[model samples]
Target: MNPYKEIENEILNASHILITAHKSPDGDSVGSSLGLLHFIERLGKKAVIGHPDPAPEFLQWLEGIDSILYMERDGEVLKNHFQKADLIFCLDYNATDRVGPEMQQLLKSTSAKKIMIDHHLNPENFVDITVSATEVCSTAQLIYELIEQSGHADLLSEKIGTALYLGILTDTGSFRFPSVQPRTHEILGKLLGAGVSHHLIHEQLNDNNTVARLQLQGYAMSEKLEILDSCHAAIISLTEAELTRFKAQKGDTDGLANLALSIKGIRIAVCLYEKEGKIKMSFRSKGQENPVNILAEEHFDGGGHANASGGISELGMDATLKKLKTLLPVYYKSDK
Candidate 1:
């Protein structure tokens, strides 16, 4: 049998299925989870989404989002689901630890068969079936391929298409990222044909911004943004106090690094924001020549796509900032 057929059979044979995405979930992870849930429902099966945390405010507008059980508040329910589930689908993230330690332990304890559908590099070997598409723009696109290739193209619906569309859109930087190929657009067209209403999604994602979020972003851009003229790089750092002043929500700083990258002559952008005593880092670059993942992996204990990746620092904010600056001159070689 084909690989997709085997995956389909697992879904068909399983009596109870559990779905999960990574912690600090973004549009791609959250979208893939909900999209898979809707697809599994279309297959006449039951699956529950057990996210490691609540969906950030911007994504709350998504339909069926309320049905998810978060590890933040639904600990008992998540445990119950894991205990009862015979199969689990891990969306977006490659490793179990990507959901964080508490959820990771729960997943490791469970005897359920785990399936991973991810578009990331260096996936671990914990899943029973791994559908790793490192070249795809997003896991949502991979999910679409799985559905289309499994002889279930008829099951595509507006709800499923909407969730997956959000995943593709966000993960691809609104389709401006290099990973987006002709096939990505073709899949998006199919989703649009299924009544996805792409315009509404674009509006919903871009138009919904809180006053505090706006103020915070403005403050960061005006006060915190700094240009490293020699390297064609930009840095934006926000302290915990600064974030508190603005009452920053989970995703208040989204797109900030990209905004910094938009500047003329800037080839790389790094945004470091202090949250809960840890500094979260967002690294972005303009092209393959300025890959930032190695910088993230070696310095910040994180890695992802070359153009876009994330890292975290246990050190204090100032120290992390210093480390980033120290590495910058050596890491990025600006062609321009």
Candidate 2:
């Protein structure tokens, strides 16, 4: 049988299902998972939402956000649920590896049917059924497709629609990214018809930043940012001391890449934050560069989109910059 057909049939029949996404859940991951969980629960089935990391504070107001389980200290709850689940829906990520170490182990040992819905590139080998289409802007779009295909589109409650809408809207950078397509707009229209409050979602996400985060942004611009190589690239470093001084939190540095990309000729942007004796790096490309491959293969242990990627480094800021300076020359050799 076709894998999707089998997966759909399983979804329709399964009494117990668990929903999950990649670790360090983003808007798209959290939104898609919660939206689908709510939809499944409406059918009177048992649906449990499991997250290995804390969802961002700004998105916590969405329905079913409280149902999320962060298994950092106590992961056995997730292991128990994964073991008992009849079916598992993994969204927004291309691989089980991205789901973090603890969750991945539970997924591996479970007898539960694994179905993957994502818009990323080639998937890992773990999933039993995979529906990955790189053309789509966000996994929320894929969730819409699942609801449409299940003949349950009318059951899309306002809560579900709003959650899914946040996924699509934020992942596309409010429709400013190149990934936005006709289907994205169509889905947004449908979501609006379903009574999703657009203004509320925007305000909840965009305007919910704390004063400390705003101050961190100001300090980053004034002190820590460095434009390099004729302003084709830029780097912003945030030391732990600086984080303390500004009282910044984890999500505070989320959009720092966008700030550098706003510069006239800058094509690549990087934000490095020192956290817990490790440096966390976020990379973004505004032009024709694939930062994911660079970070994944060369510098860090992570990969994401061609234009946007992130990773973690063991080296300090000075050493990392020396390596980045040496490595980045390849991308600019022709221009030089």
Candidate 3:
């Protein structure tokens, strides 16, 4: 039986609905959640969108973006909604822990029927209904499939199409990632036919960068980036002072790891930036030459896609940098 049919049945019977995505909401998370919110509303159902943290500035222009309640910012109100909800839709993330501490606790305590719609690998078996397809290009594309399969394809208006297109655009690295299938392009065509302005979405996400962000990117590439010729890797590390000097915002370092990957001989790119006393890492690799996901999981306690992943180090700046340098040669040898 199709699990989406079960999900549809749940949605039909439910009244008050709650929607949420992972913390540090990215385009896929926010876009998928908001796209579903618009779909449910069109069905005449009352739904509330909650996010664990603020959506990045670049995604703020999305329709219905402001309607999302930040769990960190509006805890009391979100808690009340959680209590009243008959159904909870968890989007993008595979685990409840990905929503952060407070929201994770509330989700665990809620009696609401939990439905997970994600494209991430190794999902936790927490939700009641799991509609996960790890091979899908993005969760937004999966949401589009869900709505179309559930017989609500007509509900996909321009607003919803735009949101869905944004997710597909970002998560697939502007359709450059190998994860994008022919079906992804088919959906992109349909989204465009549905009145989604692809050029506008691209401009707003990529072209409307602030001068400070560009300056920071320039500084990181020119001064901070280090090339490891032996391992065919590049790394960029930013201390808290550097971030502060650049006036770095939440999304400033979004694609810095990819920039390192653009280096001619660099197969693996790593970005280590300090945030709140811990080193947060983003890893990117070109084509599957490195298997950075395994490197992240084994060394840094993180797991993601084959080519892109993230991890963290509790070690101080210098120590973490030293640790990464130590691991590269060993991991690259084993990977080969």
Who wins the TM-score comparison? 1
lDDT of 3 at 326: 95
Whole-model alpha-carbon lDDT for candidate 3: 0.90
Model 3, span 1-336: residue lDDT tens: 778777878888998899999988888998899888888888777789999999889889998999999988999999999999989999999988899999999999999999999988999999899998999989999989988888888877898899999999989888888899999999999889889999999999988899999999999999999988888889999999999999999999999999999889788899999999999999988775677888898888787888888999998889998999999988775344
User: What is the per-residue lDDT of model 2 for residues 262-287, given as tens digits with 9 covering 90 to 100?
Assistant: 77777878898999988888888764
Candidates 1 and 3, the one with greater lDDT: 1
True-vs-predicted CA distance for residue 176, candidate 1, Å: 0.7
Give the residue spans of candidate 3 off by over 4 A. 334-336
Write one digit per residue (lDDT tens) for candidate 1, span 171-220.
Answer: 99999889999999999999999999999999999999999999998999
How close to the true structure is residue 104 of candidate 2, measured as C-alpha lDDT? 82
Off by over 4 Å in 1: none
lDDT of each: 0.92, 0.82, 0.90
Candidate 2 lDDT for residue 212: 89
- Model 1 is weakest, by summed lDDT over 10 consecutive residues, at 327-336
Clashing pairs in 2: none
TM-score for all predictions? 0.98, 0.94, 0.97
Best by lDDT: 1
